[model samples]
Target: MTPTSEAELAELISAATTPFAIRGGGTRVLNADDGPILDTTGMSGISLYEPGALTVVAGSGTPVQEIANALKAENQRLAFEPPNLNDALGTSGESTIGGVAASNASGPRRIAVGACRDFMLGVRFVDGAGNIVKNGGRVMKNVTGYDLVKLMSSAHGTLGVLSEVSLKVLPNVEFQVSLRLADLSAQQAIDAMSSALGSPFEVSGAARDADGSVLLRFEGFEASVRYRAESLMKNLAAFGAIEQIEDQETCEALWSDIRDARAFAKGQGDLWRISVKPSDAPEFLEQVQPSKTLLDWGGGLIWAELPSGTDIRAKMTVAGHATLMRAGTDNFAKLGRFHPEPTPLAKISADLRARFDPKGLFNPGLMGDLS
Candidate 1:
């Protein structure tokens, strides 16, 4: 059913007899085997754009690229830099703004800027009881009660059907540069990245390949970026073979690919997204030792594509936190301690579900049934 308005959306929700999953462009939807998908693409629109206030209120179904383009026209951007999950999924689907916030998708810039949850200012959604609810507001400092807007940011549309959203935007940087370090061991590269991050220099992206190559990005005014790059190179000469990528097109493409995890796509085996302490990355990789891996988030995130027949859960359990990226299987990622514990939080989550979706109609069991 096409829900052109909030009341129509709520009506559809109330009439959904079978369990239904809310879909925004169907990018991340195909990741699971949810029943009876309810598409929200028809509900797209931009409700408000306050350039002076650096905030934009848009329909949840608006494509992220559309929002980005709209912001870019005014020299602004989504500070969180949410990733294009569709690219990682190897599918051609529009990544809606709501989907990004709902998935809490963050890319390389997350280390410097923030996550989707951080940028989300407000959300308007229809609960399972067919009630329209709004939280937060279009401004950043709206001291409203409960701050339920953030609660729904990464809820994956399980609690409600997001109809509208407000987000914080930032000005685009003047210039961007990437520094590449080749021929260092994983531990050495991670150490170098950590060191670079510690310095006064503003490093935006830091990543390493399995082959021990490190790539660091710094964005700012041309002079500042250049100066930082030169200083960073001199500081980490021990890592070996320093090369600066100054070409705008090349630098943007490289970082964009990294942000989308395009470099790790379609490996010889199943893919896993692992989050561990940056310092422990080398040791963890050595322990699990996947055949192919790409280290990002300054070694905090590991995209490991393990060989067939490997025990993904067991390996990940040993490595602090892990999630199966893709495997043509039912269970996508196994939750670990890094994920909120399932005791009191689980009870609270269930209570919230009882309030928003008492009948358990919206994407039940998507995040593992809190009920």
Candidate 2:
């Protein structure tokens, strides 16, 4: 089912008797729900973009590349730096802005700026009852009341199907540099990343890749970036001899690889996205022993690639949550896509779903039982 306009989408939802597998670009693989596929890509195009104001409003189905091209032309960008997971998910589809928001897919820069939700200024969506709801506004300060703008960001279309989005953007950095510390153990890498992030020099990216290399990124005007990179290099000298990636193309490729989890893209395993306290990551790594790993957000986000059907939750001793980001038939049913929440949080989630989707129609059972 493809609706080309917001009104058509609302009308379709109003008359829908069966559940819908709401899809934006079909890039994000979730538990398959039994229903007609409602594709948002038909409602595509940028509505408004004010470069001077650093804001872009676009239809939910607008391709992310389109927005990026528009922003690049203006020397601005989405501050959160959302990742394109098509390769990682093994799905060949255009990545849409709505999918990015629904999944709250922020990348390494999240450590410095924030998540996709933070840059969201407003949203226009269709509720489960087919009501067209608008929340927040184009500017940053317009947020208030229930903060539905944020609530819808990561709702995965359970509460509402996003029709349009307004985002606050930032100016592109003048220069960027990356410092690499080779062969650091998990704990040492975490310690080095923590120290770099804690320093006054604005570290935008901190990640440990599969091959045991820790990379830290800094960006700004050329002089400021150079100063911070040199100072951080000296501070991290005790860890290992630092390798500097100063070429702009090389640095961008390195971070892009990290952002998309390209390391585990073609591997024969289920990919999991785990979140834990940065301080707990070393211990967590020791416990799970994933076949391959990529640490992002200074180890707060762990991308673990393990053999098929491995119940990673059973091996977890640290306090964290895991989402099976990419799954095969082996463990998709048994493990479920999202990690189970604690009792209190589970109840709160259920209540919210019930309030917004009383009929249990939108993406049923995607996030667990909505009843």
What TM-score should be assigned to candidate 1? 0.92
Candidate 1 lDDT tens digits, 65-94: 899999999999987777875555556688
TM-scores, each model vs. reference: 0.92, 0.98
Each candidate's number of clashing pairs is 0, 0
- TM-score of model number 2: 0.98
Whole-model Cα lDDT of every candidate shown, in order: 0.79, 0.90
Q: What is the lDDT, from 0 to 100, of the residue 166 in candidate 1? A: 88
The number of the candidate with the highest TM-score is 2
lDDT of candidate 1 vs native? 0.79
